[model samples]
Target chain A: MIEFFNVLLVIFLILSALAVERTKDLLSAVIIFGAYSFMMAVVWLLLRSPDVALTEAAIGAGVTTLLFVGLVSRTRRWE
Target chain B: MNDIIVKTVTRIMVPFIQMYGIFVILNGHISPGGGFAGGALIGVSLILYTLVFGVGAAEKKFSHRLGDLSESGGILIYLVIGSVGIVSGGYFLTNLDAGFLKGEAGALLSGGMIPLLMVAIGIKVTSTIITLFHAMIEEDPS
Candidate 1:
């Protein structure tokens, strides 16, 4: 059961991550990236490394995304 | 449908989701989770709202600048606490000999500053991610 869940989680993580990087809409990409990072954090938790998960959540979903968004907000949209 | 119906309901849901995030962060140590999982989940929730609604709404409720500061603050808090252990004759993050509070393992007040630190991190992450999502949305929707 645990193994099954892990596999499913991994799939979700991969899908979300792809959506983040591949999507053209910046907003959608940011949202997807946040979701992707959240899934990664969960995987880290499942692997019994809460610390890694915590940092990822903070840095990935938290800070990096913020920087990206802030930058985008200021820049004029190309399209 | 940019109408009053959705806005009214979303206003209510926001607080609930935010609180739940705190719950997850606080309980991270005991359960199969920690600050990151809970924090990111909260961050994503906020992002969903921002994406569906707008950046102005999210900014009104949650400050972007504050979120940025909080992210750095969380890390500083964690490091400060860990450093205390070293200053008190213990290695970094050494709780045993560290001159700091240590309560029961399972209790809310337990785990010394670990739980507090986790909570701080959660707040930092959630706010940061939400701010990021808002920035993206606020970008020219071309």
Candidate 2:
């Protein structure tokens, strides 16, 4: 069961990564990146590193994505 | 992502997740986790809230100065805890001879200063990471 969860999580991570790269809308891309952080956090939990996982969830999904989205909203959508 | 659904979900989830983060930070001793993990989780909750609500609203929530102060404060806490061992005993971070606290194996406060240090690290990591994120988002004057 855990293994299946791991696999599914990995798939979600990959999908999230692709979403971040491929999305036309910057906000959507940042959202996807947040998804990627969440997936990574799950992976960390599975690996028995809740500390790293927590950091991943916080920094990745929380701060980094928020910052990017803020920048996007403030500036032009694309660089 | 700024849809009503996202906001609603965030409203429902942020409190729970943020609380869990603090729980994880405090319970790091017996478990496989520590301060850094839990602090990050807390950071995420705030971050999620900010992302959904917009930066202006987020800025109103907390100032950059507070974050920076917290970062330094965390480090100072860790240093103070660690230094107690040296002040009381021969070596730095020497838990047993440091005369800080009883060394019960499984109790919450039994880890002497380990838990405290972990909490400090958690504060340091979360604040620093958040500040860095803010820097990235804030307009570069150059």
Candidate 3:
């Protein structure tokens, strides 16, 4: 069951990564990237490493997303 | 946000979030979360406030000077705690045997300098994040 969940997480992660790369709008891409980071954090947590998961969730999903959104707000929207 | 519901909810939720962050930071010795996670939690809370209420209000609450002071002060506090060991004729950061309190294991007040170090680290990371966000969001003068 755990391995099944890991496989599912990996598939979803790949989809999100592709979505982030293929999205036209920078804002949407940033949002998808946040989701990707969050999914990665959850995967890390499931791997029994709370420390790495916490860091990924905080820095990757939280701070990096915020920074990207800020940049998007300041710049042009289209790719 | 201009939406009243979002604004109201944020006002009600920020305090609880900050409290929980402080809890995680203080109890790091006995819990899963340490300084980095707790500090990021608090930092993200402040960031949420900025996102919802605008940067002016957030900066008013946590001014640049205050953030800088806390960032440096955290390190200073850590250094001071470490130096106590040297003053007592031991190596730096020598906890539990450096004339500091050593309560029973698993106690909140136990771990002597460990909790103190965690607090210092928490302060440092929180301020660093807030400062970095502020810098990124601000309009460049160039």
- Candidate maximizing lDDT: 3
Per model, the share of native interface contacts recovered reads 0.24, 0.55, 0.62
Clashing pairs in 3: none
Off by over 4 Å in 1: A1-79
Order candidates by lDDT, high to low. Answer: 3, 2, 1
Q: How much DockQ does model 2 earn?
A: 0.40
Please provide TM-scores, in order, for all candidate models, with all chains considered together: 0.62, 0.73, 0.94
Residue range B59-138, candidate 3, lDDT tens digits: 89999999989999999999999999999999999887789899989999998889999999999999999998888878
lDDT of 2 by residue, A1-79 (tens): 9899889998888887877778888877888888888889889889988767766776677767767766776777864
For model 3 the local lDDT of residue B103 reads: 90
The better-scoring model by lDDT among 2 and 3 is 3
Q: What order do candidates take by TM-score, descending?
A: 3, 2, 1
| All candidates: CA RMSD (Å) | 5.7, 3.8, 1.5
Residue B71, candidate 1: alpha-carbon lDDT:
76
Alpha carbon lDDT of each predicted model:
0.73, 0.78, 0.91
Regions of candidate 2 where Cα sits further than 4 Å from its true position: A1-19, A46-51, B1-15, B48-61, B133-142
Q: Which stretches of candidate 3 lie over 4 Å from their true place?
A: none
Native-referenced Cα lDDT, model 3 = 0.91
